[model samples]
Target: MTQTAKQAGHILIVDDNTDILIAAKLLLKKYYQKVHTTDNPFDIEEIVKTQPIDVILLDMNFSQDAISGKEGFYWLKKVVEQDPSIAVLLMTAYGDIQLAVDAIKAGAADFVAKPWQNDQLLGAVAAAYAHAQDKQKVGQLTRQTQGLNQALNQGAGGKNFDFLGQSAAMQQVFSTIEKAALTDANILITGESGTGKELAAHAIHQASLRRENALISLDMGAIADNLFESELFGHKKGAFTDAKADKVGRFELANEGSLFLDELGNLPLSQQTTLLAALQNRQVTPVGGNKAIDVNIRLICATNDNLQQAVDEGRFRQDLLYRINTIEIRLPPLRERSEDIPLLVNYYLEHFCHKYKRTLSVSDTDLQTLSAYAWPGNVRELAHAIERAVILSEGELLDISTVVGQVTTTAQPSQADSAQSESDQLVNADTFNLEELEHRTVRAALKHYQGNVSQAAKALGLTRGAMYRRLEKYDL
Candidate 1:
């Protein structure tokens, strides 16, 4: 095969015979990206250290009548000690078959005798290069898996309420997850931004047959447009400007496990086709890599958007939606299941109290007040609110003000104030100063949304930037 048709690598040749070094370099350089030869056996370590050598060709007899091959064995040990993953090919002038068998037993990849045919030399080098690549890839995979497992454990620590609810809505969700976890079907979880979609994914993976394997989670919305392919399918070294090393993609890392794609609805239509193709084919070809790697994964996707509506608007691919939604599960928002609020609140309260080493209690009145409020941001907002309350509390009672900020009377005006409409109440303030009224209105909007700037801005008919400016102007 031609050089372009073959899988190329970096070759290092170390031999005391200058003629042998010259001949090997001339022949191998035609097929490999790099071929470095040295006549001094002592320079092996320096050369290997400086270059990304995939395979090393060492002379079995460095000195004349050095047929015992002790020098070759010494250099071979040095090479292996430097990197056990590197392949070392032993070459000798003495054609001793027993010596070849001995070299194989001593960690040498292969042994080549002198007067070797050109084709035989090329085949041996190619085999050694392939061995080195395989060994390096396996090492990288093991390290990556360990790192991924560590992250997964840290993330799981916060998911204590994965199945902590007693409401009918949550019970149904648990039932569906239990049934789906038994099969190898693709699952799509639809919920508001903070309804615990990621936790649901974790629950499914933990209960499934692939629980022992990795559960790779990727936030689709967080990835940049240019990096979508490389992040999901992986990239080889030198594939792009920033690709300095080979990457194992989420799909490959989650092989025979689960791959959770969060915020999948935020993915643009242009990139949806690429993801769809990989799912349909069960294979991913890394950037700058010629061969395709097969992946066996159970797909789990979560999104806050109404994907069917997105498909109707031509913003999301219909086929892709169909592929991911083989088994759909929708989580009810906090507002929809108001009764479950107390359970979530108590859970987070205990969790935060233990975490912060504080003693705090929530009264029934406070629980009622919390349940009555419409939590637009859902469970995630409530979680932050409780944690904020715990950390900022100095007394035995949980400080609700620190959690939700100052509550404006606009949400629940007194009987006398109820007679006046919201706009009338604002206009009839003691002072008609526009500045004072504007500040009060801004503060109220912020408190009503529980500090959600976007929702507050939308409620007051202002853009996000305009809202930010107002907050800056009022210093609120």
Candidate 2:
């Protein structure tokens, strides 16, 4: 998957008023990709079960004569019980501060009053989304670490360095990695993607005091927001709908080891705050479980983006930065450290040459030119280019264009752009599109069942999850 795909977030808004639902959808649709709004409180569970909703903006009262948020409490309890990872923000009167605080203690993530400013709503929603994402991540990694095969854990985390380069930049990086690894400090490595960030993280883990323990690595950017918690912290049997078995979380799995969270920037600000809390407390509770598990772990993080800039722009949390980044190690891009290009190219070339059974080699002139060419994708891109050249080599000499000259890239559409593109295709009534017909049939079944997602899914021979995704896709 592309990096952007890993950073996507979704939201859901629930209210009894159609106008409020419409306004919330319109305002939030700009910031979030999957925005779903429903006026019926009964439909909330079905929507949550079927959709990848990160957070919900819930109204406190559903009855016209209701003044107290008793109804809100009922639904909030249901929502929290449905998935403890999903953040619910209660919307109530400005004078309901006491009720709001009570709701928070009861598990409501945050409370926002009625007639809110755009920024206030945006900030709250943003935070809710981030919180859900963090919970999801910690849960996911925990589970993932638990399910990992023994061979996978030991394959390369401690054994590989491949981090070569004796340049001044290289010497400093090597020195920092060695010195920082001895201490249990939280180390944050920053550089462009493909600049060997993961390699550095793993190296740190290998050199650390926890090297005898498992060196668990996670790519924070590639994980989906919905599965984030399940993958990190784990879930109980029958947690939500899909979790069928009790599983261990990453923190528990990395209990006495080092946990390397790659692409730390990919984490949302909401998650950053919660992650900071968990790390500070050194404890995590499994989803759907009230008991907390204590863990002793060394933390290492890496990211491709400038975290300081993201914090300045308010896209990331500043306090969380201070927590994870106790000591910072900046990796110089390959272009800036051109002296290392030759070594990197030769390493990949030799490896690819043997794999493809080709006696091909790069000439001095071509190699020099390649070393001088700007590598926008960094070492990872260069390695890929070399592999491609080896596979397609015609003779003993590899083509220069195929050597670090060709890089792979992926383009993904923004949620808005994708929606616009899907809607842009005008459907002529004269023609019958089977896909359109299927969509209509699904919508009809869903409407007939009054948004009974399970019944509709059964009627359409689809799992409820599949049915919900379609509803989201067609904006039903």
Candidate 3:
């Protein structure tokens, strides 16, 4: 039978017998690229320290006079202390089988009899090598999983929300959430559209003491002015035109839990007055009902618009804002925290790759371009981009060109102009031809650097040679 040599593995064999060492070396040489042999148990530590050893095959009886396996036991403990990941296999004569089994309990991976068969020895070695490799892989995966979970736990809680950031801005937000979690006060989350305000509200709910209960969410924008009172407070049967049966509102459902009121700034004046009354009284009076119901609930409100500005315009109630803003958490725009782009991109890339079962890797250059682009839609937009890229990816690595192609057509021209312009210009479809505009922008970058290729290349996130070739193709 032909034996397949295990590639790129190092094995250490420690035995007191010179004949056994020679025989084992000859047999193991075919399986491993590097094999180190030591006849003295004391030299095992030195060999491990100087060499990259994956597995240690130690003999149970190291000394002729000492048959109690004391030397092997002592060395086994030392080897494990030095590197916990190293796999160890113990060997003993047929009479000393009990001693070999005891060594296994002391951390040895497996045991082999002294009169070992070739297949048995080879199988043990192969299994030990595989086990060690698996340990290393699991360790790496554990670290990555912990990192992602910690990041998610630190962000605002909500359904299917992704915590996307590694920037100082995000760090500050995380620290604020950690501090806010210690209190039981009402929280107000403020941010621009698509800034994950709802997510932050969810985070507060998850981190709060009342997390066991449900987190009921109500979109103030989605509730009609006529249905506002019934939505905030439950209604008895025959309350309105659509009322066929008694219904429970968000306030009642979120009793002892968190009530997330999204787009709070959009709530009509009439609803705000009723909401303020409910907050101050710690109770609710259902529409078309005379009885008052007492409830204990934590209120968390989120909004993209400025409530203070709305209050000035007499559109939003100031008293309601004060009640909700007892503690406020503001999420900065993705452009303000550009450092988090790559981390968020990788997070979404991994998520989508797994979702699609695709093997895809992002190149450093592709990541740079993604980081430079201003994500108007924030983390949500970036996730969509990565998902699209994963779907379009043809090979082992994601093709940036394919991503760019999809992005160029759907991407608003104003967004690209806003990214390139010195001022904050809103990008709309009326701005420019995206393909021609992208080509022109690249040409402008090349001209600005005076053909000082590297500088121009850096501005456009392209290699110097690649930029020069593109310039030639465009006839610039």
Candidate 4:
């Protein structure tokens, strides 16, 4: 019998025996807000279709013509088909225990036997209702999680980047960013090209106090050298031949927000003086104008060049470097964290599958090839390769042919080696001896591989036994 109360639920009881239905309805009236019963199994369908049935108590056996429990099974499937989330409790006699268990396997929430105790019946109904509610909640949460994942995937163009790794180099980068986000000082991000310096800038900005405001960005290298002053500090009407109206500079636009200056090393020496003045004074005087505009903006600058060397050569201002380098964040190239490549690949594969409305899976061989190659362009280049593969995919699974074209288009050995030599000179300047630099390189490689002798040896172009002897000699 269903229990009656101010907040009691509506219940529907289905059985073929009139006496049993009347008795059940009488007992349920004391606990339920509404108790509807039907003696004919056929009438149960119409009652459910037209009424608000919160719980359905179904009899395992109906009339004699309904043998083998076929009718009962049909109605159970129908009810679930109509509302998969609705709770259904099966009713069976002691002799039909097997049928009750079968009904549960077929999706019944629970079961109660005939001639049951009043307390037991009420308990079963309560449990079934709770289970149904839990199922609904989980379903809603699953949909919401999927929606968020889809939105992020679409925003990233179906590519996922792994910003977390276990290497010591990555750990240092993570710690620096975390510490830097807590302060208001200007940050100077230094790293080789394609080493995710911009990503670090974004991460710091997103984690800072002024995260709500827009992060304005300007690539100093992309702008023309002659127009650098006007672009950074704005210009008044007729300030130059092309200047027709007054315009706000990046500093003014980024007020109360963050301004990310990329390729800062490329800015001419004259422009660096102006940038230094702006930072020291917290104000800017537009070209062809006398009034200075005050701004409260955080500065995050990135460069792949050695600014210290530029200062020594009289190409960059020492004063400007001191102002912008209050805090420094350095990022290692992708080759240093190659173990994270497989994780990033799987994430991107799932993302692309959902984005392109295609079901494609990646193979182990594909992952091996990607991890083996040197990513000179780093994560950005890897993302393009995956996108190209997805576009060329023709079946449910990605084939090797889909990636051949992209691999061929990447930087060749001769070009990459030349670039590496130039990059090393630019990054290191002339601060250290060759032998000392070699020791540091070997140590960094060993640390990156977690002291793995074979891996570090391969990375440093040395035999395993030779690397072990050097490690002992250097006491690394």
lDDT of 2 by residue, 1-476 (tens): 11223225667788888888888888777777778888888998888766666888989888753678888888999988887788999987544778988989988889998888878898888888889888977865655565666427446642343777877998999999999999999999887656787888778887888888876777676577776676567667777788888777667778788888876776777677768888989988777664466788898888766778889989788888898899999888776787887888888889888777888888887777777665545676677778788887787898867444442223433334433433343233344887876665664564444333445677889864576577656545
Q: List, residue by residue over 408-472, the lDDT tens digit for candidate 3.
A: 32323343364455222223324676666666566456334432334556788875446656654
Cα lDDT of model 1 by residue, 1-476, tens digit: 33455355778898888899899999988888889888888887777655667899999886654789988888898888877778999998888888999898889999999978998999898889989999977965784686476556656543466556788999899999999998999999987656788889989999999999888888776677888888788887778999997776787778888999987877878899999999999988777664466789999999877889889989899999989999999999776787899999998999899999999999887887888766655787788889889999888999888767644423444323332343465666788888879876875665554444555677989865577678657544
Mind giving the per-residue lDDT tens digits that candidate 4 earns over 25-134?
Answer: 88776776788898776776567555656688888777663446666677789889765666898876643767777888888998788788978887887788677667
Candidate 4 deviant stretches above 4 angstroms: 1-166, 404-476
- Candidate with the larger lDDT of 2 and 4: 2
* lDDT of candidates 1 onward, in order: 0.80, 0.74, 0.73, 0.71
In model 3, which residue pairs have backbone atoms overlapping below 3 Å? 156-199, 156-200, 156-203, 157-202, 157-203, 414-427
Score residue 285 of candidate 2 by CA lDDT: 72
What TM-score fits each model? 0.65, 0.54, 0.53, 0.52
Prediction 2 TM-score vs. true = 0.54
Candidate 3 structure, TM-score to reference: 0.53
Tell me model 3's lDDT, rounded to 2 decimals: 0.73
> Which regions of candidate 1 deviate over 4 angstroms?
1-108, 111-137, 146-161, 405-476
Ranking by TM-score: 1, 2, 3, 4
TM-score of model 4 (CA atoms): 0.52
Which whole-number lDDT from 0 to 100 does residue 104 have in model 3? Answer: 80
lDDT of 1: 0.80
Q: Per model, state how many residue pairs clash.
A: 0, 21, 6, 6
How displaced is residue 233 in candidate 4, in Å? 1.5
